[model samples]
Every structure is written in C-alpha cells, then in structure tokens.
Target: MGLKAVLSKWFAAWANRELEQIRHNAVQLQQATFRQLIQQAANTAFGHDHAFTQIKIYEDFKQRVPVRDYEDLRPYIDRVTHGEANVLWPGKPAYLAKTSGTTSGVKYIPISKESMPEHIKAARNALLSYIHETGKADFVDGQMIFLQGSPILNEKAGIATGRLSGIVAHHVPAYLQKNRLPSYDVNCIEDWEQKVDAIVEETYQADMRLISGIPPWCQMYFDRLSVKAGGKKIQDIFPNFKLFVYGGVNYEPYRTRIEESIGFAIDTIETYPASEGFIAFQDTQQDKSLLLLVNSGIFYEFIPAEEYFNEHPTRLSLAEVELNKNYALILNTNAGLWGYSIGDTIKFTSVNPYKIVVTGRIKHYISAFGEHVIGEEVEQSLMGVARQQGVDVVEFTVAPQVNPPHGGLPYHEWFIEFGKAPSDIDAFSQQVDQALQQKNIYYTDLITGNILRPLVVRSMKPDSFINMMRAKGKLGGQNKVPRLSNDRKLADALADYVI
Candidate 1:
C-alpha cells in the first residue's frame, strides 16, 4: 500500500475514536469542553474582561458575555488588526478568515492558535466519518481537488488575512497536501477565471478521485473540464471520482445539475463550516442530518428563531434545545469570540445524537410587512414548485415589494434563475404564490385581506447570479447570495424584483 493510503487508514482510526467518544455523551462533552475553554482563557484580556473566571456554568457565561454579532465585536477585531495581542484570544491570531457577509459587508474572524487544532480535527473527522460508514478509503490514495481561493494572503501586522479557504490552504496538513491538487502557484492566482483555468490545466489528467468545493464553482470547473475534453462528463475525465465534498450552501437545488454534469452519481458529504468555525457535518449516509460538533473547541447556544425578533428571547444551552425548532445559533469559541451570534438558524433533527439541519440565515428573510418568510420556507416552496413544473432552479432570491412606483399594491417578488423555464410563467408564479400561502399563514392573510398582490416571478438569465457574484468577488467558498432579502437592497439591484 502507498504512503497516502496508510496515512489515511491511521488518521481514520484516530478520528473515528474521538468521534465515538463525543457521541457517547454529546451534551456532557459540550458542557465540560465549554468550561475548560473558559478556565483556560481566564487570564486573557477578553476572558478577564468578561469575568470568565467567575463564570461557573452556561448560565453564568450567558449573564457575563451576552449575545453579540460581528458588529458588536468590531472594536476588538480592529484592535487585533492594529497589532493588539490578547484582545480577543490569548495572543494576536496568526491568521484572519475574511468574508463578505450578506449583511456585514466584510468580516475578519480570528483564527487563533487555540482553535487551529479544532479546525484541523473537524476536517479530518468529517472525512473519517464518511470512511467509517462507507469503508471506502481508496480515494485518499488519489487526488482530492480542493476548489479554493488564492493561497497568497496579505499580512496585517504579521498576521495573514484572506478568504477562509486561502487561510486554510496555508496550513493544510503536510501529508494530505500531497493529495491536494493545483500547485501553490496556481492557487495563488487571484483572478478567479485565470485561477480556475490553471487548476483545470494542472489536474485535468491527474488521478482525481475526489472533488471538494462549493457546488456552483465546482460545477463551473466541471463545465470547463467538459469543454476542454470535448464535452465529456467529469466522470469521463476523472473515472475514479468517488466523492464530492460540498458546503457553503444547500445542495438540494444544485444536486440534479451536478449529477448531470458528472455523468454518474457520486457520494457527497455536506459540511456546515463557517469563518467562525467548522460547525457540523454529515456523519451517516442513512440519515441526512449533520452531527453537531459538540466536542470541538466551541460552546454552543441557541435562541428560538421565531422569537428572536421580539423584545427578549431565551438563550438555551446544547441540552436545552428542543427537536425540530428553528433556533439562531450563538457560539462562544476558544478563538475568543464570546457569545457571538453566527447568524444562521438551524433545526435539530435528533436531539439525543445532536444532529442538525441549517434552516436559514437570521438576517436573510422577507419580513417587510410582518409576514416573516424565512429561507427554509422559501427554498422548500421553490423546490416543490420547480419539481411540480419539471424545472430546475439555477439560483433564486425573494424580496418584499412593499412599495410600488404607482402606489400599486405590495407583493412578494421572486428573481429566479431557471435551467428550464416553465411552459407558462404566469402559472408558475401562481404555484409559487399558492405554495407560500399554504406554508405561511400570515402570507395567506395578506392575500385574503387584499394587503398584497399576487407574488411576482421574474425569469432571470441563468448567469445573472454569477454576474452578481463576479461583481462581489465572492464567486465561491463560504460566500453565498442570501436566499431571502428582508429589504430591497439586493432585490432592487437585480432589477428583476421590479414589478
């Protein structure tokens, strides 16, 4: 056996052992790990500032730190940028994971020494989880194409800063780096188009067994690879392509397209990773829910999503979370982000084993007129209507049409990028509207009371979202267009939201 295979086997056993222990007592593990982190960092500035030493339990932590978002932590982050050490973590973070958030334009999340091992462990465990279940470890012997950002990062006071993918690129485990394709030179090409071209050139004939990325960009690469190989499916080019590791967005809408591009069905593992941390990952093929990272260097809390917009909401610990309720995730990390709201909403599919499904983004919703429609609801409705109409949605976003130019009635507007346009656009719009009304009662009340007109469906060119992504320089890797915009900011810019 080759060195890579032997290495994979050894790592798999170690990771799976750690995973099994966490699963043994997920809640107890989270509780203990959280306390240990607080105690370890009690001497640090942030910890001392928050009285972490005085905090005995989750309740004490809640009382001391309170929930915060990126904006609230900006001052601390700014201090870090100006070379302040131990502001958030024990020392200045060696790297920052930069992201353009849908709401917060730019964010610099600290990647601290304390959390580096956790990040590495989560990634290894994710891959090992799949191997443990499937008993397929041969792919590690071949290439694992990581579709990532430019690896060359700019330094801020001796601290590296770039997209999370780039930050991770600089630290990929030396052994696994051999299995990763696209030379550092190719990866350092900042231009997305040029970088993608270079990656294809380097890996087109390599022994590619796994392709991992955000689905859209990976699909883009496959499309390019097909054209380069005279319209052959990705499977034709990489015959042993065994797994597609994907994250950064829901895979349901893109699954059909990706499978078609690949020419054969391949196993896929979904991960819930963010600039803040690697949150959870799919562990079992039989069940679709992701197993929460209870023992990672992160402490978790949740506020009921439906109640968060109220004057006050309850913040619950891991043990307090109820099954199948949408909750906005709050995280306290070893990286020194105390009680930070990650902004994503999730639902627990299995409370005992701590399995979750990402429900929506807290800031990404349509609540213009008190009819709060979330991302999960919108996606389900769109997926259902498309399936019914025998169409595929390339990309989509929904917004509230609260004001009409001519003082006309208000409505919900959908800007849809479709692979196959419905035979009758009007009929499709009705289906979307009705499906939403059936799912959301407040929406039904709006229609029943004549507060709004029928929802609008504007067919967008398939590449419309791509154009927007290109303009944002966030075409892939943990960056995603919000599925539901509470305001007209993004919808208005698209022009398709215009009634």
Candidate 2:
C-alpha cells in the first residue's frame, strides 16, 4: 500500500479502538476524567484555594465551584493574560482565543499548554473517526480547504490572541498543512467579504477533498465558488470533494442549499467545539448524534435550561443528565476554566454513550409574551418549512413586535434573508407561521386565541444581516444572528434594510 494509505489505515484502526473503549465506559471515564482534571490543576491558584485536591466526585466539585459566566471569571483571565503564574492554571496559557458572541465584544478564552493536547487530539480523532466509519481516506491524500477567520495573530496581555479557528489553523499539523488550501495570505484578510474573494481565487479549482468552517461563512465561500466556476456546482470545481466538516452553528437550516450548491450527496461530520473546549462530535454516522468528549481534558456539567438563569440552579454530572431536557452547559477544565457557564444549551439524545444535541444559547431565547421560543425551534421550523417549500434560507431572526403599528395586539416580526426568494410571499409567511405553531403550542395559542396576530414576515434586502454583523464588529467567525430575541434589539437594527 502507498505510504499515505498505510498511515491513514493505521490511524483509523487506532481511533476505532479508542472509540470502542470510550463507548463502553463513557460515564466512568467522564467521572474519572473530571477527578483527573481537578488533580491536574490542583496546584494552580484557582484550584488550590478551591480545595481541588479534596474533591473526589462530581457533587463535591459542584459544591466547591459554582457556575460562572465569562464575565464572572474575567478577573482571573485578566490575571492569566498579564503573566500571573497559577492564576487560573499552572504557569501561563499558550494562547487565548478571542471569541465574540452576539453581545460580548470579545472574550479571551485560555488555551493552556496542558489542555492543548485534548484540543489537538479531539480535532484529529474526529476526522480519523470519520475515516474509520465511512472509509473515506482519500481526503488525507488530497487538498482540504478551511474557510477560516483571519490568521492574523495579535499579542494581547502577553498572550497570542485571535479567533479560535485561526489559532487552530496556525497549529495545524506540519504534514497536513502542506495539503491545506487558501494560502496564509488569503486567510489573513480581516474583512469577511474581502477574505472570501481572496479564498475564491485561491481554491476554486484545487483538488480539494475536505472543507470545514462555520456554516454561514462556508456558504459564502461555496456561493462565490459556484459563481466563479461559471455557475457550475461545487462537484465540478473540486471533483474529489468528500467531506463537509462543520461546527459553530447548526447545519440543518443550510443543508438543502449546501447540497444544491455541491450538486451531490457527500459525507458530513458535525462537531460542537466552542471557545471554552472541544465538547462533542458525530462519532458514528449511524446515530447522527454527537458523542460527548469524555476523554478530553474537561469535566462536564449540565444545568437544566429552565433553571439556568435563576439565582440557583441544580447542576448535574454526566451520570445524572437525563435525556430530552434542554440544559445549559457548564465545564471545569484543566485549562483553568472552573465551573464556567459556557452559555450554550444542549439536550442529551442518549445517556449511555453520552450523545447530545446543542439546543440553543442561554441568552438566545424569546419569551416576550410568555411564548418561550428557542434556537432549536426556530432552526428546526425554518429547516422544515424551507425544505418543503424548495427554497434556501440565508439568514433570519424573530422578534416580538410589542408595539404594533396599527394599535393591535403584539405579534412576532420575522426578518429573513433568502438566497432564493419564495414566490407568493403571503403563502410563504403562512407556511413559516404554521411551522412555528406546530413546534410551539404557546405560539399557536397566542394566535388561536387572538392574543397575537399571525407573524409578520419581512424579507431583507441581501447582505442586510452581514451589514448588521459588520456594524456590531461580529462579521464572521462563530458569531451568529441570535435566532430569537426577547426584545426588538436586533430587529430594529435589521428592519431598515427590508425589501
């Protein structure tokens, strides 16, 4: 066998064995792993004072380390950035990934040398797992394109800082870097649109086999690539394309459009890697659920989503997390993030092997009129309606119009950016309304009882959401339009560009 093929086979075999072990004893590994994580960082300033050494199980750990958000731990992170030894972790972090969500301008997430291996291993093993399960080893031999954020690194508070993806790109294994496309120069462009233009020029006709990135940005790349290929499908540009590896956003809403762009079916892998840590990935194609990363250097916790925003929440360990409840994710990592509320919500699909689906963000919810609509409902409803309508959704957000223009009762206002605008706009709105009502009974009752009007749909002029993101300094790289908002915060900003 050729050298590349031989190496791929070896790696696949190793990963398969590891996956088996993880599946067999996921809960045990999870508990033991947290204990190890505490022990590993026990001497660090945060851990030593918290009595990490005395904590033997999940309950004790929870009692000691209360769940905290990024702002709550910002002081310690500041200490780490300023070169304080053992402030949060031992010594200093190797890098601090800068992540900005809908509201937070930028939060520096520590990447410790001790925890870096988990980050590296999770990424590699995810791909290897895909190869083992799907027998798709040809990608390793051919080019892979990462529609990454700027590779521009800045020295901030005595640490290297950039988007997590860029930091990861900078650390791509030397061997594989040789086969990755869109040169470093193209990857360095700060502007999202400009960078996409450069990327299109760099990789349109390359023999690329794998593509990875956030869905919205990758869609931008694919859209431009299709145009550059003279309106040909993605398969025509890179015939050997085998995988669409993605994270940072749900791919369901974009799947139909992406498949249409690619012109054929291909294998896909989903990961739930956040700035805090690598959480989960689609381990086997059979389940279509993300297997939790028990072996990664992070201890996990889940707070029931309903109680998460309350003053006190009941925190549960992997063993206690029940299936089908939306729980806000929490973590204590070897990287020195202790009991940090990651702000994302997830639901356990399977507890045996510990698989989960990200349901929404803790802050991304709408309960303006007691109708609690979350990210999952909005995404699933949109996907279902768009798929049935034979249309492509670009970007969307829903806000309760508390102040109705005609002195009527309050109602939802949907601002959508459509790649292919649907004909019969009223029918499209009805479909969207029906889909949401089917998913959320409260929403249905609000309309059925005449408490709220049918949702108002306003198709946005193309690029409005992009402009909004740009205005907010969150143009790309993991930042997303909040799927649902309690107030007209984003809706007011986006309505100016309605068609």
Candidate 3:
C-alpha cells in the first residue's frame, strides 16, 4: 500500500473507534423508554438548530405541515439549488445524492455537513451490524471488497441538481477516497451513461473482498469478476468475502443467481437504504426481516396503507405499529426531511419493536382488471411454483400484457422467466395460471372457464434476464429488471426488445 493507502487505513481505524462509541451510545438510548427516546431525539434536534428548539413551534406546525414527499420539498431544494444556503439548511451543501422513483424524476437530495456524518455513520453501521450478526468483526480486519460506486470525487465544487447518487458521492470522506475509482462529485457528472460504463470497467479490475450494494449490481459484479478471473470461482477471487451486505431494492428476485454466481453460500445481510439515509439493516441471520435504526437520530412514523391511499391519512409512531402488518413509512430525519413518505411498504416480521421487512413499493402494486397483486404475493407464488415444479429459479420478472378477449378489448396477461422452461409450455402455463388463481381469488373469478388461457412463461438461461436489463443500458450497476407492471405496454415493449 502507498502512503495514502496507509493513511486511509489509519483513518479507517480511528473511524472504527468513533463508530463504536456512537453505536454504544445509540444502543443505550435505544433501550431507553419510548417517551424518553422521543424526548431525547427532540432535544437533539433542538440542539442541532433553533428551528427545532422551539418545541411549541414544531408541535403547532407538525400536524399542519401536511405529510410531505420529495415533490412537496421541491421548494426546499430550490432554496439550495446551487449548493448555496437558503431556506432548506443553514450552510452550503457539500454534494447531492441523486435518486429516482415512480413520481420523483431524478431527485437531487442534498447532504449537508451535519447530515454527512450521519450518512457515513449509517454506512459504517450497516457493516458493523453485518459483522455482529455474522460474528465477523475480526474478518473485517482482512481484505474487504465493496461492490459499490466508484469513489471518484468530482472536480466541480457545488451540490448536484438532479441526481441523488451524484449528491451522495459528493459527501463521502475525502481522506478515505480511492483514486482508481470514479468520482463521487455529482456536480461534475455530465455523461451518466459513460460514467456507469467506467464504473463497470474499474470494478472488473479491482481487488475486492467485502461486497456491498443492491443484489442486481452484485450479480453484474460477479459477472465481471468471473470474466476477469478467467471463469474462476468467487471463493478463489475473494475467499475472505464471507459477508455480503445489500440494500436499495428487493433481493428476492436474484437470490439464487447471486449465491450461484458468487460460488459460495456465505452470510448475506440485507439493508434498507435510500438517498436520504440508511433506514434499517438485517440484525438476524435469517433473511426474513430487518431491524429499524430507531436510535439513528431520526424519528419514524407509519401511515396505514388503507388510510394513506384514502382521503384521511393518520400517522402512527413505532409504538402504534403491529406485527405482520403493512404500512407506509413516514420519516423525520436530521437531514431536514420531515414527515416524508418514501412510497415504500413494510411489514413487521416479529412483534418485537424495531424489526420490519420492506415488502414492496406502494406504487408497484398491480390492480389491473380488479386483480389485487402485491410484490410479496407474486414472489411467494413464484417460489411456490418453483417448489411444485422441483426446479431452481435464478431470476424472473412478471409483466402484465393484454390481448383482445375473443372480439372485444383484451384481458390481463403474465410474462415469466424460469431456469428450465418445462417440456410442455402449455401445461406449465396452465399450472402458473392455477397458481395465480390460488394466490389471488379475484383472478379466479375473472376467468370463469378457460377464459384467459394459461399465462405465458418465457424460459431463459441464467444470465439472459440480466442481459436484457443490460441491453436497456441498466447493466453492471444498481438497476434491476422491473418486477411488476400495471399494463401491457412494457410487456409488449419487452416482447420485441428482450431476447
């Protein structure tokens, strides 16, 4: 290692100590009474700014603020439009993290100096939690590989305007920065497509051990790593990569493929991440639920899905949520995000407080033709089908298409990809149709007889689906094949585009 690398290592050591202190304090506070915790958080926020000091002001304005989303905070973003301090925050923004969702067109999320430490702490805690769960604290002292974006710092010196990822890159620690990776400065990013390509290239050559990021990106990294190692197994490249930490989006779709690609059935932990902050991380070994970061200097609330989508929506605190129930997440973070609904749906896996699993994006549900379909339902159904068929599935996506029903307008359709397409496509389709009917009774009622023939299943090789994603310029990074579609437009479009 060079002098800079040595310094980076030293900095990491010191950072680890600081992280331990924070974790210790956080756990102590987390164990405190709920009311006490809330008061502490309120006090902390108050100390952080005068705006928060006036409890009466916040109380009076809290309910009146109207639960907000990214779009609702557009004006706040406009205040810090050029990294300059305005109504949003007190100081100039270091950089912006660009994030995309159904409604928000590439949102430029600001990361301030005060909030920067929290983001860094969240990233560190994700690793720490993985280590604690896997008993791999000592393992972290070894060569670690992070399959994340390039650590390249952008030359431009202002908050990025549109991209959440870019803005996040700007706030990363400058001392621990790597010269070989891509810049984190979103302001300097002009050609995003080229940047993604560059990221893939460097990831292909880097010596990595500790892997991170979304499962889709990890699949792409494994592909590149496989090629670079001359098809050598993952255990050979990074035998020390005993732990895999992933978040951002769902991992169920690519679970088996990743285990196969990495050539090891290692300890894997999932995280709930966003441009705003790290929401939760898997605290247990089982891949069922996540432990919400209750002590992470943020206040959380949940809005019942029924009420959130209806005329009157009421917010519930962590104390009000129930086990095995789904709700929309509303957050109030030190990052200046208040009453922000991130459009994610989550369920408490256990009755114990602070543990939940992100089920799906609220808008990602499919209710076309009156068939209410959820992501978990579709995933479970796919798992059930795979079990019944006795075949291992690497990856799959469900796209709803429509063709004319006899002579009038068409009914809904299904498109699926399987590891081994059954010998009889027609029979397999029938089984899938039955599975859908069994999963959702509404679909059963719609198709009285052989009304809508068996849903279509398109079998492809292991990487074929990922390749299709790549062809769409989404390969080798954080993007994944969209799981559920509302209409046939995407399915119809995929027919010609995907092989």
The RMSD (Cα, Å) of candidate 1 is: 2.0
Q: What is the lDDT of candidate 2?
A: 0.84
TM-score of each: 0.95, 0.95, 0.77
Instruction: Show model 3 residue runs off by greater than 4 Å.
Output: 1-62, 82-86, 150-157, 160-207, 387-395, 402-412, 433-441, 444-454, 459-473, 497-499
State, as a TM-score between 0 and 1, how close model 3 is to the true structure: 0.77
Off by over 4 Å in 1: 1-3, 496-499
Candidate 2 structure, TM-score to reference: 0.95
lDDT digits (tens) for residues 354-463 of candidate 3 = 57888777766666666667677777767676657755666666655455535543444545556555667667667766777787777677677544444556665556
The residue-by-residue lDDT of candidate 1 on 223-332, one tens digit each, is 88999999998888999898999988888878878888998778999998887888999998888789999888898989999878666679999889899899999998
Model 1 TM: 0.95
Candidate 3 Cα lDDT to native: 0.60
Whose lDDT is higher: candidate 2's or candidate 3's? Answer: 2
The residue pairs that clash in candidate 1, if any, are: none
Model 2 regions lying over 4 Å from their true place = none
Clashes of each: 0, 0, 17
